[model samples]
Target: MTKLQSGMSRRYFLQVTGSGLVTATALGGSALQARAEPYDTFTWISPRGTLEVLDDYPYWSALKMGYFGDLKTEMQPGPSDGTATVKFVDVGQADMGFPSPGVFSFAIENGMNLKSVFHMGARDTFSIAFRKGEGTRDLKQLEGKTILLGSAAWQSIVDPMLAAQGVDITKVNYVEAGWPTWATALAAGQGDAALSWEGLRAEWIANGLEFEYWLGVQHSTLPANTFVVRSADLEDPDRKAFLEKYLRGWAMGLEFGYLNPRAAVEAVYEQFPTFASNTGPELGTTSILQQINVFRGDMENREGWGWHDMSSWQAFFDQIHAIGQITKPVKAEDVCTNELIAAANDFDHEKVKADAEAYQLSEEFAAIDVENIQAHMFDNAV
Candidate 1:
């Protein structure tokens, strides 16, 4: 993958630590305190600047439902740098990190000894959004059009997705319109389209930047995001057990969202009132339901949530490498595993579903017509 010119890099990570840009005390000093001792708090870092986004409904749901009973947890919103989440986990600053498959692969290529423990997004969540009535029914029509991106680093993400659809990526132009504003730029006619994903689609509408979309969840065959941790931790029994427990909480949380998307949105809203006030209950629920669809793709054929389809992952790796996004070859088994999947799924399904059905909602959340929202969830999807 191409390194970000203004973002984090392997050399930058090493140089920063070596030059004291990051204080030793803040980075666990010399002992890496986060991993050296068995701690009560399990920290999961986000790949973005804030955790207020609706994409993390599962974690917020788990937090609200007390699914992680007695297991102290912390949700740390890392920097907006694309590589910060994996870097934090690599240096023991955080216990786990949620990274896109592209970012995870980049970390591995840079020699970070990390393993994806839980495959959270079973399907690709990336998408391309065009001004309403301006998108083509076929991706090939985008060959000569420009696509807006939050950062140049995202080109690596868009390349393979376009290639998968047989689009001539060489003919496509990408413009880095900057983060937190790419959607607005698209609305202002700054570009022909902007990169987007499941949860963000609803949030964009709430922001009044509605656009027609070619959703990756419906088009791309690549693997999506996953939860990764230090590989060595998996060998230790205590850490391994804790990892399973953490993943189980998320799995149950996903189940909860599937059963009651409104309740899931209510949980997220309780955790992030500012975000709730901005998007309202209807759009918040819409976002949660959108991700629910990605998180649990082809449920009938899958063993459970967090199950990795190694074949599909392998194909994704092959496609990226073929497109020259990855310089070195990557094997699916080396980057991810399904060992924790069975243990993570060993939970009381009936109880989780019951909890979802019984979850109390705020007046606004209670008034949301989730069925109607779901029924038109893909209205803008091309």
Candidate 2:
């Protein structure tokens, strides 16, 4: 198979398993009639700043498409830090928020009652990018070399990737770095390597940097970015409705994005016009379509579009516990619930698959080439 074809096959296999599809009842009249109460409005918090693409894009699409019209959602923006977002949810300032699974693992270790409802990206898109001539084919080569990282959570990710390759992190020199300053720090020769996401990889490559990636190894332990809610909120009927409706709308929005790349690109650009100037229209458009394709292509045919697997969850928690990231063993039951995702199963799965496949073959998918594919797939923008 050609590289593109191989990529498509990989995409299909990942979606089939990653999307978490389980055979279940549809949200037919019987399911809807079973609800005993009326829906109420709820507030969701997303990270603030222009980088809202990861957290706010789906919500924005849902709102634009009237996905949450029935539940009446009010979105509030919070700081980008996942830990801060968790605090906002804990204090009841927000009913729901976006946090990386690493943050969730940290909170659960500390005995926080957090639960993740949706999986934002199918795979870990963050990586450690190194200069090409550095002889750094693997993490082991970094032994005794200084590496830059943004947060402790990043260590959780890097630790395992290195461990698997038989490299001990204790042997490496670690530097605490700020997210915004990481790219420049590496380019200026201040750090041997930088922990980065796909977007940063694209930016670096565009600027003439030669680098190889160490894609987010977090998925080997935990889900990447997930929509999390406090455990107390799961029983609320409105909260349930909000999640169900939101997922449905999100699935649709993803499909819409896949089917209409130019339109989706315009929508994303409209929301974050600064990208046009910084990355230019061509690269910006490429970045957005890559994300849309990866998300839709990998998740379209799965049983749960954004639900976590029980085995995967348990394995992740086990790893987190071993690393001292959590004080106690975290259970799958404690961190995530399938109630809402199970409810979404009532919608048409075959139709969802068909739409997603059509999207994979659309012009938007075709517009992306392999080298740029990795970059766009993880673009932080919508």
> In angstroms, how far off is 138's CA in candidate 1?
2.2
Clashing pairs in 1: none
Q: 222-260, model 1: which lDDT tens digit per residue?
A: 888899998878888888888899889999999998998
RMSD to the hidden true structure, all candidates: 5.2, 13.4
Q: Which predicted model would earn the best TM-score?
A: 1
Q: What is candidate 1's local distance difference test score? A: 0.81
Candidate 2 root-mean-square deviation in Å: 13.4
Writing each residue's lDDT as its tens digit, candidate 2 over 1-382 gives 0011121111011111244431112121111111223334466765322353433445555466554556666766554343555555554445676666666675565445678887665555556776655634466778888877765445655664555456776787767676556667777788888776644455555555656665553323335566787665567676566667767776666655555544444455556667544654455445555455334434545555676666666776776566666678877876777767666545654664454354333354356454554454433221
> Can you give the lDDT of residue 161 in candidate 1?
86
Q: Which ten residues in a row have the lowest lDDT in candidate 2?
A: 1-10
In model 2, where do residues sit more than 4 Å from their true spots?
1-41, 47-56, 74-77, 80-82, 203-210, 217-222, 289-301, 345-382
Candidate 1, superposed: residue stretches over 4 Å from native:
1-36
